[model samples]
Target chain A: MTSSRPRPATIGDIARRAGVSTAAVSYVLNDAPGGARIPEETRERVRAAADEMGYVPGAGARSLRTGARDLVLYVRSDAAQGPLASEFLHGLSRALRGLGYTLMQYGAERDRGLEAARAWAALRPAAVLADDDRLTRAGVELLAKGGVPVVGLGSDPERARGTGLSTLVMDHRAIGRAAGRHLAGRGYRDLAAVLPAGPPLRAMGGERVEGVREAAAEAGAAVRVHDMAYSPESAAEVVAGWREEGLPRGVFGYNDEFSGLLLGALLDAGVRVPEEVGLVGADDLVLCRMLRPALSSVRMDGESSSATALRIAEVIAGGAEVHLSPWTPVPVRRAT
Target chain B: MTSSRPRPATIGDIARRAGVSTAAVSYVLNDAPGGARIPEETRERVRAAADEMGYVPGAGARSLRTGARDLVLYVRSDAAQGPLASEFLHGLSRALRGLGYTLMQYGAERDRGLEAARAWAALRPAAVLADDDRLTRAGVELLAKGGVPVVGLGSDPERARGTGLSTLVMDHRAIGRAAGRHLAGRGYRDLAAVLPAGPPLRAMGGERVEGVREAAAEAGAAVRVHDMAYSPESAAEVVAGWREEGLPRGVFGYNDEFSGLLLGALLDAGVRVPEEVGLVGADDLVLCRMLRPALSSVRMDGESSSATALRIAEVIAGGAEVHLSPWTPVPVRRAT
Candidate 1:
């Protein structure tokens, strides 16, 4: 079955077919300076032979020889789900492509820290942009030793500073704070925060809850935290429990999708939004505006972060050091 | 700055530091059968030297020598957005990983045609899974010539047969047919189909509309198609127009996200759901059960499709020919 498929033509095959030396074929194919010295007849023959044979220079071979690559690998600790992460990745891919680099998203093994780093290092990518948890101290050192620039996304800048990795700090706490302040200003004294129940979302959920706590304390408001899975059934159960115990008029769900789920569950349970429960979510998604009462949210500037990450990649590719401040989340108010 | 960063250790560096032959280092590092002849003291010394120096094998050099890669590149014509695509990819990634393969998602240039294929071919991936539109005939031929198996997802199987590329037919039209039949059975005579406005979604939307048309024609029902962008503003405008014209009671939005948007828009306009408008969506997303009226959807077996794709990929990797039937879409009924 393998023989049924045509084999890729190699430089050796092209040279033999063109009746030229391997060096001449390489020169012609790469358009090297020495190619000018080759006879015009020989060059044309080489070109025609290459075209007929469908020859594509192997990226692996070229990278090994040049010690550089046009590939930018983004390694995530887990799969990126939901609309906000998808949009951010799309924006980042476009930004990197505009700079003449291909963005490849790779899902790394969660527990095999050093082994995963070794696998990624083997790719010889020009740069590796990763989620904070994807790379440990040893993993970062291994990649740096392999001459690959590493950038940490959604990580602490101070920790990244010691490892020489450029960090793009995503302040989930700031998002929580924004949502908390917005709900408090709306005169909602009793508040509740919905945290997603998953290992991947645990860190983020904790930071958000802390931020909400800080703001709630400042506003002299009482706050309760709820751990819920990202499923309709879980949301309905929470709504049912809340209805029985009296619901908090102002609540902050993790993101728009979760917030939308909570909102729907409330409406399904015969609860009126805003009048009975005003809700806020983060990552001001398109769904926010489409919801019944509309949803208020905290907007993270993904475009700015993507642009900054690209710029930092450029500097790192040039063997330069760069530092940037963490991004701040802004509140977007709607009907909710 | 490049000088400031440490360099990775090579085989020669390990050999010299450990006072062993390069062949001995290779045998020890690769854990070759020949390592049994080497003394235990020398093996331990070599191992310590390699680890202390942080030596990692170069993937580029390895691929160039072995003529095979561990990469299965999944190139989407556009970004994977929303819950359905994301979930499918996540499942595919996990399945592939379990089979000892890494799945890399690449967003290809929408209009680059053959040039894009050349870029992908240069990478020398073991397999390429792409949308039907991403690869032209020439592109498919090029990849096959390079000894890379190609798989087309959500494409015409007949066309795939001609190209010798394994295909996983998603049957979007079947999804539409299912939705149409469900809506018609519910006794809704007037039906409207919402199609998203974008190049990536254009093909899929058309197929779904065609399926709805087929079912509507059989039922002698009137069907209208609406072109709307995936935004709240667009949805609100659609609702406003519908209200002015005395809207259709049954609407088949492209997917759950769009259906949710339309449902919210209708509710915000003081329209009662189900009582005034019956809605159906596809993908049976989590949002379905959360909505006030609980959206009815076509449940696409993404997990089954993903599993089938992985199985086919494994067969292709082993130089075997395998054919499977297209997946069927099942309609799931809920409140709406």
Candidate 2:
């Protein structure tokens, strides 16, 4: 591997190594229109040459020539919120970075302020990935108006209609049903559902809460609905003040972060779980399992966004618009 | 608020808004002596105009005018092998971004890759934020010879004296001692520490493992160590097969992620924490408190990275060098 032999192999070097011209190399590597005219033997030789010479193309250069970065944005309504958002971000960043695309986070929740979007818009991202339903309509419009494609990560597909936003919805209703049905099956009658205080999650949390009510009703348990702001202290305060409401034997947190918070507070207040009060959380992040008693919740597959990113790139590259479906959640049981 | 307001609120806009010439506005804004004398009343008016118009300078534009980006590269020996590296990075990025400088990450951990100083040189960052002790003398010489200022982010501040790299000394040894001492205070003599596995984390995990051994010795506990791979399933499998070693009353996971894994696995095996076995995990992430019993361990001042990033920016902007002591960790306890 002498420097003279092309210290870092370029596409042209690969073509030269394969006894072909740069145009043929572009045809083979870029999926250029004229690639069909290139002989199969020559294409194989170019590929083999590239492999042998470790000819990984410069991503920036490719983006310039192809007019695509293959990048995706994961927009949070706000940057400062939730372990799930952060986890999704960490994984998505790591995953996308691994796949050779930049993960630009667009915050619907801007810690950096509103001009942040205008600034981010300058990056000319290939697509907009938003989670908020209301924002999905507005964001799809916001970005589409700016000539950027949009995809909804964990949003309701049906609700996103007419916005031209492709969907990768996370079925929060199914998650609530699983949790509610799980607790109802544990033979509990009196039950309470805890939801997020924010409107962004009420749709999902409310759906889940409704599911719990429906499931508990079917199991013949009188259901009580409790809207508690998430936070260990807040959850504890709610439960502490509500002892007179006849403490329900089961509680479902809006998500794993809240579930874990409530679980600890309940245990600290000397309320037992499953034995006295069962807990069900959503998303089932890795941390859920890290808790001492373990956390059980509805597992939403995480790979959908990555897949959506891939599909979004396809769409932007002038491929046919492929419809994506909403995600379903499954029940996972751990200690609690 | 009209677009056609007398001024648009740029430097030029400020001059127009204040009814002053651009040269007078520039002199007032820069606090420079006017080439042609400008009155103090004019300066005050210029300042008021800038404020009313809500004009602020961009960091990049400032850097361009000043001949430096104020950016720093927190170069790593290997990101995969590090525990503190991620924390260091998270803190550094949060800090640098807040301070108007970009933070870049790079690794030279593949052996003699330290001689890979060319990557560091290519970026021409204001400073190379790195582990001074980890880089070979040749590597450090190569970077320093190129006139690139370096800042060390590790336990070996003294090592920088030999290499001319300014230091941010972090005490991994102290982190171990703190965890070990806390567990010992809980009256548990048999201690087991879960170290991270993999070549990237080998050095880091070993360092913490050493720190634990030192603390355990002082605490009078016979310590046995375990190396677990980077996955929850791996931690579970290790715990599942731990009958041969016998259960320790107190255990410290290398970090919160691993600690969470251990907690989950132990709970699944029906081990009662503190009652049968006490558990402690480091990094006071939200999940720790969210857990049923809640995890207890050391709390590193991760939020302090902002200060560190600001200092690095100063160094890049030709500010005097800084030396930071290793951040202290506080013992945090919950029910367990």
Candidate 3:
């Protein structure tokens, strides 16, 4: 079907156009050893012919020859979302760019393990960065076999044990613990944590809830768990029954989005903020400030993007196994 | 450094492990027509050996032979953004996935032309989808030469006139005009449109402002331009000076994010929405509903992602040039 279009020029085509040997064309294009012996005039002619023919050095061919390319493939899943994720990506992108590497995000939905590795291996990227949820031990072995370094971001280090993959722990539990401590320290004996009733959120939500429970136990406060969907209606429904269920004086509404929703619903239900209910959210989205009573949120800080990028580069360069805890959750106190 | 690790098992390795010729292995693994004559037990043995060794058929080798891979490379830039962009992507991804195509997002920040094309061509993707701002004429031609279809999403169709790119016009001007019409029709003689004061937002912002102007001129209303940064401080500063400069009865606060910012500041400045000042925003984010006096917005409607994906698929199949206008501006009226 594409026969009508001009074919991509190969080294042989450039050589034919320049009236030189394929070896000479390669020497000129790649600037490899012995290219200095070729006359500058011949080199210029080869380059001109290559430009005219719209020749692009095949990355696939180069990868096949060198067994690696200047690419950092990030295998993305539905998890690891929100404004923080965006910030991480923008920072990571800029840092990788500075390091002369291209960051490619591959959507790995259904095929996360062995199947995903096969597809990534075809590109022959220098390294692969993936979330632990989507990465399997076998997948890491296969990619390592292909000479591709694998870095995994997860909540636990044990999951990546024996896989030869560098691990960056997100520490969502710490984030939850931070939120729990902030609210509990404010002298609220009745506390609650809102967990999203979705499969994708279940694992992370459970961890955060566990952290909140740990904090509550230490603070001598009773903890209640509320299952809420990611909808305004669900928020309103949860708020409507708060009074009868003995309204918790402090609530951890999962993340900033859910916290914002709960805050809005509480206000609509004629409940007072901090006086009636002190709320905390994670991720510290900008919406926290935009809300009526600025939200108090748990923010993952301390690790800069450049530092993370440098670590990734080190891993790609055959460095020893590294573990990074970039997300140190710090609670920012606001009106709410 | 990677020499110590075992290399990926090749087809030859599988052949040797299964005690069969490479040709027999290829036919068995590929399920080629001639493989029908091969004994079922031998085929199973070959498959078992391949599985044991974690032998994955190289997509690079397949693309080198077939000239295309089941990859749709989306060249992402900073231009197209916001929640609507996410919605479009989700829809497009689902559609492409249904077609057995893997969608890969490539970050093209500084490398937007020939340099970008060279990187994309390395993957041997079936098609390259990019914003018109990023895809140059030379880049398109080079990718076309490599037998990759180019699809561009932009505001102007003329920029892609000679590039043979399937264009999807975002029509920001139409969106602005819709907001302008809605506000003007409500009997407001003085109208204003918020334009973000950043280079990345400039082109699309300019087009949207022009659209608002066109609608204002048609209704015999005065149009005032306001350049604002993407910060609460900027919004507050703009609102603080509104009384001194004669507050416009109608205002189009760019998209929902800026609009939400403006709404908060206006209320802080004691200006009643839809009473002292009627306000509208574009993209109609969920934040519109969350705010008090639920925002009136101009939303791009009537385009299903499935349809766009289908069109893209047809284009990849070498169909004729296609122009799609999925973004039809529709003004959604709320409290303000």
Candidate 4:
């Protein structure tokens, strides 16, 4: 069963096998300019020879030859986790693959900053797609200097635009505001918003808290901010503290994971959901429906975001200028 | 904030500033063989010139010069989602990064089979890491022919070895057996193992079911297999059927996500856990602690697996032979 390994066939091998010149093989393989004028029979012979040997044109070689790259690097922040991140990646991967490009995910070096940008630039990707925190002005300039187009995604369009990147800014504040409005409209005047404590999450959490505060102020409701990790113990402590202080009956956990953890903690502490406390989460993850109270959440359309990013990347790859756009989040009300 | 983009510094620029030949600059930049003969002062001058201009050596150009690659492609099957997958990727990414290699994940083209292998080979990756189903003999041979090392991870060590791949055989059966043993030790006789219905999951699930059956047989208990999708409605239907038939008192629902979903369905159906039915999950994801009754699970050491894979990858990348290893799963006992 163990046959000796055969070497990968090269264009020269194809040329020899097809009784053609090396240049003709290269032209046929790469579909080079003026190669269409080659006799159809000769082209077919070259392709057949290549196919017989299972020859694949190396992307590195192709890029070097044509100055066209097939890689699009997506720099992910530390907070790039959960169902939302997965969905976004899947969508982006599909979209990029359709455009004959591979989406490569690189973990952002937050502390390294400019050094990280230079490292990414070293890859010489056709484009770099990143969120706000990962897309610093120096990073954009470095990438752009290397002739790689840059696209930035985040809550702040203005901040992304400041870096001169093609920006697709989604309103995370709107998600929080929607959750706040739902809870406040239900006659819950006292509310508490849970924010996951971490540098990676703080920026988004702060924006969400502001939105909650804005909605709370409009309804003459009070909002308390709780900074905690996404853990059952952390949630349990928050619940205990809320009970001790007699604070709020309505809460908006940062996202579904936090909401799920908090829900479990609340239930463990004998707090009946809705009857005792109402909760809302973001992302509207599938787990939301599986939970006892069926979590209410703000839904961001990752598919649309992915489509827009891919389109911008395609346009930029085609040497066209990019225009900025703003995306909004919608709320889905459920049992919670 | 948007300054006009500057051109990326080239080797010629570095050579000119350092008052050296392009070959000398390349030697200094790449630390080429015999570069030791270059005076320390000259090397320092070249380094300073490169830093001053923010010169980054492109991966493409470097690969061509050194005949070495920096890409370690991780081909993910469709089942690559959820906490377990995320944890595995994070661990692998960190491990590879420490070794100065980027772990690029590509979604496997399962349906395309050998054609998919050809597509991956086109990327000219330094190595390819994939699971059993995706790493076919033809794929392995094709990659090997291109001088690309292949690593396969799955339950079937023999099959993976048959393809001449560096195999890390993780026993899914052991995971299921552990779950079965835990439930049986708790005096639960009748057992049912839930297998998620999908091409990507069926192979692993089948092995797990066999393991459960083996354990059940040892304890003089009966084991039944339930095929369901990873959805709450599917879980609810299974729970409903079990209730109507009075089938089993112990169940293992694939993994924590499925366990959480099943637990919710069981609770909604008024079935008390532990007292009425014992449940177990795999992966022991964070959600296990957050779920009601807390999920009992079979814990596969993703960190160890990732480390081993990275070690094998590094060895292969350094042109060394690969050794095979067996990895076992351990069960964590909890409320359910």
DockQ each: 0.58, 0.14, 0.42, 0.37
Candidate 2 shows a clash count of: 9
Ordered from best to worst TM-score, the candidate numbers read 1, 3, 4, 2
lDDT of each: 0.80, 0.65, 0.82, 0.77
Candidate 4 structure quality by residue, lDDT tens digits, B276-322: 88899998887888777888998875447456756766555553445
User: Cα-based RMSD of the predictions, in order?
Assistant: 2.9, 11.4, 3.1, 4.8
State each candidate's clash count: 0, 9, 0, 0
State how far residue A27 of model 2 sits from its true place (Å). 21
Better of 2 and 3 by TM-score: 3
Query: Where in model 4 is the C-alpha error above 4 Å?
Result: A1-57, A108-112, A301-306, A318-327, B1-56, B109-114, B302-306, B318-327
Candidate 3, residue B22: CA error in Å?
6.6
Which number leads on TM-score? 1
Best by lDDT: 3
lDDT, residue A83, candidate 1:
78
- lDDT tens string, model 2, A1-336? 321211234577777789989988988977788789888889899988865654545333454466555556555552244545554455545555555554544333322222443333333556656665425243344455445566656656576666566666556666777788887777777777887787767667888877777777678877677677756778887778657566788777878777777777777888777677778788877766676566788787645556645555565554233456536677788765
| Per-residue lDDT value at A274 in model 3 | 74
User: How would you encode candidate 1's per-residue C-alpha lDDT over B257-282 as one tens digit per residue?
Assistant: 88989988888888888888899999
For model 3, how does the per-residue alpha-carbon lDDT over B1-336 read when each residue is reduced to its tens digit? Answer: 434644557889999999999999989887889889999999999999987887766677766656666889888785334567766776787789888787777667777888878888877788888877788888888888777788887725676665677787788889899999999999998998899998777788998999999999999999888889888889888888787898999999988878878887888788998799999988877666666667899888876889889988888876346777777999999976
- What DockQ does candidate 4 score? 0.37
Q: Sort by DockQ, best first.
A: 1, 3, 4, 2
User: Could you tell me the lDDT of residue A12 within candidate 3?
Assistant: 92
Angstrom error of the Cα, residue A182, model 1: value is 0.7
What local lDDT score does residue B263 receive in model 3, on the 0 to 100 scale?
Answer: 81
